[model samples]
Target: MDARKTIVIGVANGRGAGDPACQDGPEVLRSLKFLADLEQTHAGFSWDDPIRLAPGESSTPLDAVVQIGTQLAERVCSHLRQGNFPLVVGGDHSCAIGTWPGVKRVLGDKVRLGLIWFDAHMDSHTFDSSPSKRIHGMALACLLGIGDRRLADVADAGAKLLAADVCLIGVRSFESAEAALLAKLGARIYFMDEIRRRGLREVFAEALQRVGEHTAGYGISIDLDALDPAEEPGVGSPVAGGLSLGELTEALTQAHGDEKLLALEIVEYNPYRDTHFVTARAIHDLCQSLIP
Candidate 1:
C-alpha cells in the first residue's frame, strides 16, 4: 500500500440533478454497503462522515451547486494537507470546482495540475455557449479558468490549471459550440472512436503521461455518463457507446501509481434514474479498486 490513508467524502448536495432522485444517491450507496465493501477490499480504507450542504442556501448566484461545491473543495483540500487520499462521491459534476482547489493548495506553484475528465459530454460549455446554462455542463470550463468568475476563482490565486493540461476521455458526444471552444482552447481529447482504435490501456497510459508531464500531480474526475448508459443509467446524462465498467475500473486502478495524484472525484450519480442500484454497485467497485 502507499501508506497514505484513504478518506471518502460523500457530498450530498443535489442542486445539479437532472432528476430529483440524485439527492439520495449518497444514502443509497451507503445503504448498499458501499463503505463496508470498500473496507473489506482495502483494510486501511474508510469513509469520512459525509458533509451535507443545506438544501437552499448558496454562496453564489450562479447556483447553489457552486456554493456547496466550494465548501466541499475546502474540505477536500484539508484532507490532502493531512496526507490522505480524498475520494469524493458526488451529487453532480459541478462538484469538481470544489475538488480541484484542494490539489491546487497542496502543489501551489511547485507543480502545475492536470485534469483527466472522463465523460460522454465535453462538459466544456461556458455560460455564453450553453443554451440551457446548466452548471454541470460548465464545470470543465470553470476549472480551466474560463467560466463564471466565482467558479474560475475556486483555486488559489494564480494556481489554476491551463487548458492544455486537461485531457478529455471517452467523449463521444458534445454540443457544436462546446466542440468549437474545445478546439479553440487546444485541449486534448480522446473520443470513443479513438478509444476503440487505440484500446483503453493505451488511451489511459497516454492521458496520464500527458497530464503528469507538466504538473506535479493530476486530478481524476469521472462523470458516470462516460460509462455506457446500460452500465450507468443513474447519471444525469446517459450516453451510449461509452466505456464499460470494467474498463473504467482498470483505468482508475492504474492511476494509483502516480503518488502525486491529489484526489479522485466521481459525479452525476442519480439514484432516481437507476434501476436496482446497478450504477451504485459499479461505482462502489471502482472505489474499492482504487483504494490501494
Candidate 2:
C-alpha cells in the first residue's frame, strides 16, 4: 500500500532499433554495484526480473517490439495496481509504446494521461515516414494516436496520450516528416536551442506545467541520447549538444514526490559504447535523484 515503493522493470529487447546492442542495457545496469546499494538503503526500491522477447518472436521488428511492449505493459499495469511507482529502464526508446499505455490502463479510460518526452530525436516517424523505419523513432507518434495501429493498440485500443498533454524536450535530431507531424498536431517541443536560451530548469518547469494541465497524471520518458554525447556517449544514438548531467538532475528533482507524476522511463543505453561506465553512473545519479 506504500506508493513510494518502486518496481524497476527492464525491457531487455531492442529489436525495434537499427542496433540491437542496447538489448544488453538492462542486464548491465542490474549488476551495477549502486543497484545493490540502493536495494539495501531504500527498502521501497527493487529490480524485477528483466523482460525479454519470446524465442520465436523475431519474425519481424514490429512484431518483436509489440511482443515486448505488451509484456512490459502488463508488468507496469500490475505494479501500478499495487500502488507502487514503476521505473522502466529500456532497451531502446521503443519501450514508450508499452510503458505509457500500461500507465493509462491503470488510470482507466476516463483519466487523461500526460507525458514529457526527453530525447534527441522527435520519435514521431511512422513506418512510411521513417527512412530507416526503426520503430524506436515512431513511439511518440503512436502514443499520440498517429502511427502504426499495432503500436497504438498496445495496452488498449486508441491513443495512450493526448497531443495537448504531451511535450518533447532536448530535440535536435529528427526527420522532416516527424517534425511536420508534431507541428500539425500542435504538440509543444522545446528544442535544444530553446532550452539553451531558457535554461533546462526553466524549460522543464514549463514542460511540467504543460503536461500536468488538466491531466490526472504525467510520466517522464528520457532517452539517454538527450544528454550531450561528449559527456554521455553510451546511447544508441548520441547527439552533439544536449543537457548536462548536473542541470538535468536538478530539474528532475522538482517533480520528486509529486503525486501526479505517475512513472519514469530512461532508455537507449548501449553498454558497448559506454566509456569507463560514465553513462552508467549518470543513469544511477538520475535514478537516485527521483527515488523516494
Candidate 3:
C-alpha cells in the first residue's frame, strides 16, 4: 500500500453556529497532541500542520463565514492539487460551506462529486427555512446550490454538488421545512431507524454504491452529533438514538482505502460539553480508521 499524504486544516471560527465554544475544538485536539499520536500509531501516514483562520476578521457572522470559507477553499484546493487527502477539522458544521466547494473547485466541471453527510440534524435548511438563522444548519443546502448566494457560490457557483448525488446518513433531528425541501429535491436519506432495520453495513454499502456509481469521487462530512449523545457528548447539537461509535467506525474502516473517497470533514466538536475528552478520543479513533 502506498503512503497516504494528508493535509489537516483547522478552522476555529464558531460564528457560523452561533456558538463560541466550538471555536475551542481545534485547539483542544491540538493541545492533546492528537496528530503526533496518530503518527506514532500508524506507519505510511503523514500530515502537515493544520491551516487555521485568523481571529477577529469580522464581527458580522456572515462576513466572518465568507472570509473563513475563502481561505479554507484556497488551502483545500492547494492540497488537492498536490494529490493529498484533505482532512478538515472544523469550528462547527458551518465550516462545510467552504469544505465541499473547495473539493468541487478542484475537480471542476468534468467530475461529478457526491456528498455523504452524516449528521443528527438534516442540515438542509435555507435562510428562510431555518428558525435559528444558524448557518451550521443550512450547510448541506448551500453545498447543493440552494441557500444564500454568498454561501452557495463560495467555491464556484455552477460547480455545486447535485442534490440527487447527495445522501444524508444518521439524521434523527430536523424541522418540517427542511424535511419538505429534501423530499421536494429528491435527496436520499437513511434515517437511524432505517439503518437499524437494514443493518449498518448494508445501508452504508448502498449509500457508497449510490454516491460513487455516478460520480468520480465523493466527500464525507461527519457531524459528531450524528453519534448518540451518550457516545459523543461534546457536540453543539445533540440528538438521542444516533449511530453508535462502533457502527460509524466500521463504515469508515470499510471505506478507508477507496480511491473514490476524495475528501473528509469532521465537525461540531464542543469540548465544553464533553466529559474526559471522550469526543476527542472518538474523533482520533475515526481518523485512525481512515488512515491508510
Task: Tell me the tens digit of each residue's lDDT in model 3 across 1-292.
Answer: 6355766777787888877788888878887876667666666345555545564454577777777887888888888888888889988888888888888888889879998889989988888988899888888888878888898788677437877888999988899999998899888999999998988888888888888988988988899999999878999888999998888899877788888888889999998998988889888888877755
lDDT of each: 0.79, 0.90, 0.83
Candidate 2 residue lDDT tens string, 1-292: 2357878898898888999999999899887754667777667788899999876564688888998899999999999998888999989999899999999999899889999999999999998899999999999999998878998799899988888999999999999898888989889999999999889999999999989997999999999999999999999998899999999999999988788988999999999999899998999888877766
Query: Model 2, residue 100: displacement in angstroms?
Result: 0.4
Query: Against the true structure, what is each candidate's TM-score?
Result: 0.93, 0.97, 0.95
* Model 1 lDDT per residue over 139-229, tens place: 8877777867876777454337777888999998889988888899888999999999988889988988888898888888888899999
Q: How many angstroms is residue 152 displaced in model 1 relative to the true structure, after the best TM-score fit?
A: 1.2
Worst 10-residue stretch by lDDT in candidate 2?
33-42
After superposing candidate 3, which stretches have Cα over 4 Å from the reference? Answer: 42-53
Question: In model 3, how many backbone clashes occur?
Answer: 0
Residue-level error in angstroms, candidate 1, position 82:
0.8
**Clashes in model 1: which pairs?**
73-98
Q: Which pairs of residues clash in candidate 3, taking residues 3 or more apart in a chain or in different chains?
A: none
